[model samples]
Target: MERFKIRVIVTDQDVEKVALDVRPQTVEELKEIVRRHCNLQYEFNMMYEDPDFGNALCNLNNMDEVPAAATVKVVPLITSVSPEVTSNSSDISISSADTVILPSSSRTQGWPEVFSIPNFSVDVEFRLRQANLAYLKDNKTFKCPWDIKRNILQVLSEEIYKFDTYPDENRLHEVARALIGKHPCLTEAGCTDGCSGWKNSLYYKMGNFRTKLRKAGCAEVSINSSKNTPGVSKGLKRPKRCEVNFLPELPEREETLEAVRFLLAEEMKKKNPNATTVASKMDQTFSLRRREIVDVETPVETLKERWPALFTERQVFSEFNRIAATNLNDFFEALDRYTPKFVSIFKTKGGGVGETLTEFLQQIDLRKQDVTALRTLVLRGLPVLLGDDPSDFYKTCSVTDDDGVWAQVSIGLLTVVDEDAPVGPNVIHLEPVSTAIIIEGSVIMDDLKSLPEALCILFGLSYALHLDYPKSMKNTLNFIQKVMLGLGHNKLPPKLQSLKNVLLS
Candidate 1:
């Protein structure tokens, strides 16, 4: 057996040499050996010089690939390193000026879980490094300067905006907690959790930050400004569900609002407009349309006149993709995937709702039903099962009275059933059933093939036109938003969680 000597570098001053009797097959095996020899406890990455690339330091993944007398550098994965920790090796040097490498775990465990925080400015990084050093060296709480705190808040607010335009208290707390977790030196000594004060500061900072963003023509924040939402509260115009791009900023270096509007109008005039171009233009003008609908509260008719392309099915899906950052096809696929499980769960119930669900199931041939019909059953049955009154959302009426029935519904499925078909207490044989989406007492989309399609279009219109979920179908809509679409940021409500548990089980 031959022994290979390897040099392990922890820091500029800390180096250890070890002899290996047999070559380690994997990186983990080598890491274990280095960790034992150096007594290293912190998570770190091992970098070895690659002779092929001017001996540049590269991540050590395969131990067998290491050169015969390679020197490995151990880089601790830390967010804020104390200034006392120094590195002098030319390949990997650490200084007060360089940005500290953040731990990979922080990406999953840190605040604003949906979005990653942007790198802090060099000045802010220097301040954080100093704060960490002072706290570690003096063994006393370090107070962050006001300017540094402000800059930190600014960076955090920008990242939060990517996930939500107006983050609520819960969201704010997550950011605060993450800050302290990453840099314990910044924790407030007076607070019980050491983060409450930070959370409060973040709340106020976010308000001011939104104001600044609004001034900069950020449509997402501007739509909720005091001037835009009158008589209504700040949250009224904000996204009720987790909408990642509820109203994104206008495209960079694109045409002005008026110019985009002109281009959009011109595009609508073409008999065979390019779909790729149309989608691109529609994406560019999303924020503007959102402003008109949410801020101006423009009437649907007026909006249709102004943005004719928006009412089309293609644009409706496109607008939904922009708001939720999800594809409609994936949404339907999820709905279908869970339909059988949902039906099984619904069958176990034993109440008025259960009986209703049973009737619904009886009407449909579960084994032979198409995906559309299965989805329709799931979408319609969900409201009833969730205790949300579906009388208003999924209304059934004869062909003669559908117009009156549809007119009464603000937003929901208007199923036109056959008048002559056999009707039971809660069962109506749907033959050649037709479903339409009623928005603001108007059928914006008619002859929808399935109730699920109508529901999808209605959900999209809620974001596209800035309409609220109808009071009667709030729970069902919330289920689709949170569970089906997977847009929720918080824990599911009791009933929703219960259903989710069963579905997963």
Candidate 2:
């Protein structure tokens, strides 16, 4: 059994040691155990300095191969939004002249996740060469030369002034570390783990960077600036980290509809004999008719009230169900394409050999067929199949090849009373179900239609499913309410219109 231990560092400057047994458990299990023991947030990520690759994202997939007694850092994610900077000077302060110890809390605010930064690409070798930072030729001691550090600071000074606002201290640390790690000489100085010596060195560089910018007549706001004090972010309050609700003004409904109609009219009039003459006349009229673009600034509540049918989730789902059921055969066929083996079985042998639909019906005494069992199976299975229950794996057959699709085979057998003449469709007399049973059937059918079937099932089942319903379908659910009701006025091809009406009714 391969066994190893690692030092785990938390964001709150706490450290713990964790042992790993790679023979039995995977790296994912190791992370879970570490996460639970450390009390880290679920969203927190892990990183390590590989002997071969330097600093890299932890490969939880191959923890067994990692050398024993390695150290890993648990870094908090810097969300891709404006972060709140504390007003307390002592909490975060950068000296204008010399080195300062960066308060541990300062790392909490910078963009730590490198990938989130727009256009960020690290070319460590080029950076090291350009900065005069030394690389290990053999087994040399990891020490970043002073001249290299001074040159790096000079570069940082130029880079700082180019920024519109003061860069976050954590961002500077990350940027410095990226360059530092490439130079193997900086490893002993603790650049890989973002050591105190390296951090202090980076901070002094930033202090000089800020000082140079100030002296060059380019005044800059520091990240530690008080929100109450007037500066670059005078009226700027840190935006609340709530769900983003962007409200972009859109062209007015009437004008957009007119534009669509104008384009559609051009297409329709193209087949006319005097096409060129008509086209010019239509273009002239359309130009004259076009008005200034008005923007929709209506409240959501008002818009929902204006078009109640489009806004309600339940109603839209119901419509989708109704639309799907209109061409039920096509819908099932689409669903069948998703299950090729099952379809092949049905198509070749009428059903699976021994458990065939014909065999089940043959054994059934029409005089005493269990209606209760049939109804219970469907009622119980349909919802569980459509719902979010992971354990409902057994309910796969209820929606696909059930009575909804096999209506001719199953319903026909239920109607047949005589056992001798097994295949007489016209003479079969299905016993009268109670009005309650009929209603139950209707309810189950309704629920079946409203099911959130997969997109493949919708499209693969029928070509007719591709009919243009509305512009709302192009975007995600959030945009549904924003789509103008007038845009839905485009007449769906006859088949889609019928399907849509079934739901509306």
Candidate 3:
């Protein structure tokens, strides 16, 4: 097996933690596949280097040692020669500047078991250009495999302005999680094992609001009034749906509902010529309206109340209170300091919640015939939202099947049993988006495999269009990030079963 180096860039932009090294091996003949497996052109590129690090070919027998995963320490090299030339070549030697070593304590323990392909050789040939760096410059390295306040400062900006440097462990974990690719929880004794290195009441240990992040998945409840409900003298009425009052509406896959509203209104007018007068009467009845935006400022008193959640003693809060003098600006600053904590608490997916809904319905026995109808009714209005299927992959079903598009979708099935609250008629369900696309289904799924059945259920659910569509272009960028984590460095497809041990270990 031939070993090739790989570099994954973990940026500081709104991320928790990321790693830099991986080892992968491939055949010299079908080398192009390597690019597909890990490259920026696809969803896996966000975590990759523009000038990727890997060999061109894999030697035989040594196949087991393929460079499936490695963490990288990205250091910027400024040389006398142009930076471009240095990257253009396969390798370049640089004069030593300051060296930052990972102190071995930084690695977390116990992550999940992931998979990746085996090692291979490289057949690359390139000339090396000179690389240079000035000794006067400062260098930074992260996750130095160490646990120390000093080292933490090393990774952050040196020109220290007074601010709360400590977020919580959960927040820190999440920040690390976002910044790094598939990380382990931190410890004084670092455990590099992805899934089973260490265990504790991590969620409970990190208590209070300071400990929780948005990713822990907040509970949401929506209150809405409907006109079709029973009235004092009226007979039984048709049920109306309750809507969610959302802030900065949840994101869409590709198309906007606003674009189609005009046409729909026109159709309604055509169907009822006297509709204007009827509409006036209809308006007098209950109508839909946008949720009112609340501009109430987050209070300092609220922060003071929440501040104690981060620590045992009020010392840290007291120190900040001393500086900010109990003012709103100080509270806002405190909130910013604690922002990192907010992320870590949520990113950890919180329990087996993904399985909770399914577990509740595990005993259900849906006959083949019933599932077919349920799927049909459930996906009725989602054609533009769920997306169309390509020959192979779904290829972003939420976007318009129009020419160029990118679509991202998150789907789940919710069960219904109560007669009083039977699943009603909305084929696909979605919340408004501030970012990201989320889709929900209410069908029993013992067999979502048969091509005909899958199509029947999923085809029309594409109502909102794919994420690849133009309106959702910004959110689609995240697809690249998630895909990278799902398949890049140490992440291999199911075929590479033999290499699974090392990936999660």
Candidate 4:
């Protein structure tokens, strides 16, 4: 038995931070300290499940008696061992070396855990960041609803700066070094930051923060992607300048996330014993152009350059100005559902997969409410996917192959859900054209936005799969309708708010 110092913080009567030493026999005890000490402010999220220093805690706030909802339902999505249940699973044991000792910084003034819904990515990193987000959402706000927004912003600020939860590049490299025998270097491939695309992240070594972490960092020969670990210089290889595959018959529904989630979910669970249903539920929460704030410590004024429309929109998108605006979540979902799943694999012309992915990440921009709506859509899609006949409802990333010899397509998607409404969910969708499709024809280019969702889905596949971005842009507009006819709004209004005010809001 080993003696360890444990501090569980909660808002007891006043803002109180509790510290105690725990002699834990098994891994389960780490969780118990969190549950009991946390009391009303409970956060037992496992960022890095090291069997070592008890489990890491989520950011907790406030103190209160157990509310009725807490006892009424224990929405158990992820599995856990019951302290009272005597069984094999409950016999918790942890390794001494892996325990997460509260760092000196964490003990004095605990830092938060921040996450981002990155353009390219990894699952573990995403989940690690999300654990704090889960706390932000679940934790209670101040009694006066007036304090809600301020409280959220405060939490957001703290969490976004929470970088310690997930590993940086050096950390990931260390893990890779353990497996590969040396720090792998990039040689031939053009580097784009890792675009694990959907469920991955770009990380750097804490030590390497001074250099261009996104570029190739190799002391010797370059490491091929199959052998390299994630978040490192994600390899991007360019295939010969190829024509877009001419296969017109591939069904669009084949590439949607609904089609892919289950297969991926099974694989993900093997790696994460605890990331069962809870993680899946969190995945359901993101939508087109969703931005989970990582490093929230950065103030809003700094983000204003990129997110100018937010403060300005309550300033820019009005019936006064003719600026066009559509439901962000809906528009992105539309694109995700109908867009062709394209890949610009490392074989693209002199480019590597990393660069291809970084390009994808750079294109995305979104409004806040739009993301919340995506969660609703994904959650709704989950049940259907787990059930039968879910193909028609797929996300439309990629489906029909181009009869084997056709050129590949590229895909980009945005799903935005407006969270302001108390009644039901709302979303908007968006997609941007890659440069490859420009060569297709003048006719397609003339009416780009009029294209249908399915064709746009097809067009998006041209990027990473190494089709041409310009070539597909023209082809993509084949179906986008300018006027959302059924929504009681014109295609492009003389004034943007005139359209938004009528239906979109």
Best lDDT among the predictions, by candidate number: 1
Candidate of highest TM-score = 1
Off by over 4 Å in 1: 1-117, 130-141, 214-236, 247-273, 398-402, 417-419, 422-425, 428-433
Worst 10 residues of 1 by lDDT: 101-110
Q: Tell me the deviation in Å of residue 157 in model 3.
A: 21
Instruction: Estimate, for each residue in 302-324, the C-alpha lDDT of model 4 and write its tens digit.
Output: 33322222222122122011111
Candidate 3 lDDT: 0.24
Per-prediction count of colliding residue pairs?
A: 0, 3, 93, 120
lDDT, candidate 3, 98-185, per-residue tens: 1121111111111222211111111111100000011113221222222222222222211010111122343334333332232212
lDDT of each: 0.70, 0.34, 0.24, 0.26
Of candidates 4 and 3, the better by lDDT = 4
Error of 2 at 233 (Å): 12
TM-score, structure 1 vs. true: 0.69
The digit string of per-residue lDDT tens for model 1 on 336-449 reads 789889888778988888888898888788778767767767876888877788777776766767477668778877777677755333553344467777777877777777
Judging by lDDT, tell me the better candidate of 1 and 2.
Answer: 1
| TM-score of predicted structure 3 | 0.17
Ranking by TM-score: 1, 2, 4, 3
Displacement of residue 118 (Cα, Å) in model 4 is 18
Candidate 2, run of 10 with poorest lDDT: 239-248
Q: What does candidate 1 score in Cα RMSD to the true structure?
A: 19.8
